[model samples]
Target: MSYAPSTAAGKQTAQQLADISRTLYERGWMPGTSGNISLRLPDDPGRALITASGRDKGELTAGDVVEVDALTGLASPPGQDRPSAETAIHAAVYRVTGARAVIHVHSPYATVVAHRATATDAVTSVRVERFELLKGLGLNDPTSTDLPVFPNWPEVDRIADDVAGHLAACREGPPGLLLGDHGITTWGDSLGQAKNRLECLEALCRLLVLSQSELHVSRA
Candidate 1:
């Protein structure tokens, strides 16, 4: 489908997202077409531009983005490219946290930690404490916090709804979350901040996994 031409600001946002997507993809965090990134248009807070569905993250171009309603996640111009299936989740984060950018990635450590943390289906959050990297999240209490983890419901909208509910209740919570057996989502006032927080959280997950492995070996 032909998309409406983007304004200069929109073009910049798209390029920024494309650049970040390729960087993450090259790091193996967004293998295949598994991740999506978005930015709320500064001039129109009610609208957002998100990565289009099924495009290889490593090769995204400025034209690969779709402008969508921030709340409904519908294409804004009515016939633009289809937004990612997870667009609603990005919208929810923007609405709840007033974030300027949101990133979702399937990095190995974060995904593995999310999977293990949710081994008990009823688990709701993953607790991390005394991790200096927590400062990167810009949380009210970075020394320790429970990062909310939602079930990776098969229906993307259901996950979005749950995210909205949790974020609404925890207004001062971490700027990121985990999806059971899925991956991590992070947001920030800017794309650079969001990417930095994502790296911090993923590193924390890596440390958690390594510590667990050390404990297991000692026990064995």
Candidate 2:
């Protein structure tokens, strides 16, 4: 895929992505080099600016940005470096949902939720309920929303397939999903909106873990 050059704006998008990476890292949602971010070029549907692999997301810079073909998930501009190994997952979400940005992070809350949900056989059945935070999720109404959790696979394409299937079946609201023992992936119509949703999801997951811990303490 190719997009008309928006050279000036592309630089700004790179900076924005770098800023988000550092923010997520500081919050412990993306410790080490465990997350990636990508933003769609405002003027081009076929190209995206994504974080290059192996950089410390906490210290990302504009130089760490790489352009990619949004459709084929390939690096653009020929000799530019490859994107994060998870780039395919980002591309899949964009292809499936028409979203303009995506955030993936190995957050503690998200990782804990994934493990807890898997152990209890609730990976597919667990529902986030009766929380005001649900509103932030952009569901049509403030009601219980079931967030699907898929088994983790090393191959990004397999995980992407499972995510695509879940979204197809759910068929409502903003795009977000959890990979069991991995992390969360969320997207939105714009970069800011996507970042908001990612933060909200992380917060909600943390709250759930805290509440459960308190309940266990009380029971004991």
Candidate of highest TM-score: 1
Error of 1 at 108 (Å): 0.8
Query: Would you list the C-alpha lDDT of every candidate in the order shown?
Result: 0.84, 0.77
Q: Which runs of model 2 end up more than 4 angstroms from their true locations?
A: 1-6, 119-125, 213-220
Model 1 RMSD, rounded to 1 decimal: 3.9
Score every model by TM-score: 0.93, 0.88
Clashing pairs in 1: none
**Clash statistics: count for each candidate:** 0, 0
Candidate 1: global Cα-lDDT?
A: 0.84
- Global fold similarity of model 1 (TM-score): 0.93
